[model samples]
Target: MLDERAAGVFTIAATPFLPDGALDLESVDTMVDFYVERGATGLTILGIMGEAGKLSSEESVAVIARVTARSDVPVIVGVSAPGLAAIRALSLAAMEKGAAGVMVAPPGNLRTDDQIASYFQNVADVLGDVPWVLQDFPLVTGVQITPKVLRRIFDACPTCKMLKHEDWPGLEKISALREQEAAGARKISILCGNGGQFLLEEVRRGADGAMTGFAYPEMMRDITALAHSDPDRARDIFDAYLPLIRYESQPGYGLAVRKYILAKRGAIAHPTARKPGPALSEAAIAEIETLIARQEARLSAL
Candidate 1:
């Protein structure tokens, strides 16, 4: 099971869909192998990148079962829902299907710190013994979780073992959380996830590792590996990829770009975002290709 000791790249695996928008289970197998071979220490399926909200509950369970079965590394399933019953139901299915743990993001309606803290306490009560990740992506969730509120939740929920720290300008949160842990607060793992834009700074600020789908899992792997021992080289590699990273970080269109690159890398067969999700324009595709070429050239030069 996932614990506070969990570290390293847990690539947020994309849900593969055929041109007709069917789940490409074959690609799920290949994508699992691709991420693991590329040095992913774990795989996080059914995440924002995985199009979790778009999938049916049955489809979600299928993904959980398939990924957990194929992954040599541990698998974390995102089970965020509008209600605790849905969260508990999905989390239970994920655990029973062999997932290492589940991830939960707060609903956007949470306003007060007490409300936020109380919601997760209820989540913990429903989850019981299932180790879970608290996904703190304020940019998407519109729910800001302060470090103090986090401390309260952690103190209350023993099974919440990891934090998917994706808050923008959140490096200070990482530092603050570590300081709190130093002062005897619960010490859960902190894995950052703003498409890895702040991964280097995050690790430097006491993040355990990255939990984002940056398309290039190897970059996260290498940077985390070399962060403490060889900061200069790490920065060099990070700089080489920063352009493509920034390009892929665009809101609304990022996942389309990510799926395109993943398909190009042979991790998946098609780049189809499901209906209602954005698709890349021809000009956007050209831009991403140019960025990838330049990024590769820079890395080679380095």
Candidate 2:
């Protein structure tokens, strides 16, 4: 079970790009080492945080292979393709390349509950014995895995062991799952997926851990520690970090800000994102610099 094996802070890492917009393997290695050194329990690569949609299939596979080779911790590869065939192929490839587990979104189309359940079942069938993480991001993928549908999928696929719940009313679903488990339903780990903004809240509501994309790995560790060690103290840390989280969560600047922080911390070679996406405005860049400066000063004080 993913929950039993990986019940701590997991980072969904960003993919680093070169100045010419190519995948930077060296930078990827550095980021992997940085996270593992800072206490990440596991690594989720080729995820939304990694800009999975932007990478080619080969690039995605290479990223998974490199991270898996470099890290001792579990590597969960994100399989986010829309079509069932494509997703199945990618999942199999990830498994073959030594990915510890596969994370999947519901079939990209707006699926009916039945279709959604069947989609997961098919993925589990194709994956054979490999563990799977059900990624529940309704806004981006346009499919909602209702509780009833989730029940069906879990019943149908014993290998579907975890879920990354990103639905808006996610805590309600987590509560419902807990109720089901208490009443003899099968146990499945639920990981929070809505960045770090809601991570502390999700843990309080019973999430096993998080798959957030926030820049500061140590801050995330602090959040997790507070959640487990002292709930009230965790809330205090979350509140104190709220301003930085809000700034980093902005739509157009989120990735840029994260990469900038990584660069500032000497974790990555460059803060470049793939082309077709516009560059961060000078104002946004300055804001990120200020945030980075504040973060450094705060960390130094600690």
- The lDDT leader among the candidates is 1
Residue 201 in model 2: shift from native, Å?
1.3
List TM-scores for all candidates, in order: 0.99, 0.93
- lDDT (Cα, tens digit) per residue for candidate 1, span 187-231: 899998988899999999999999999999999999998889899
Candidate 1 to truth, TM = 0.99
Worst 10 residues of 1 by lDDT: 181-190
lDDT against the true structure, per candidate, is 0.93, 0.79
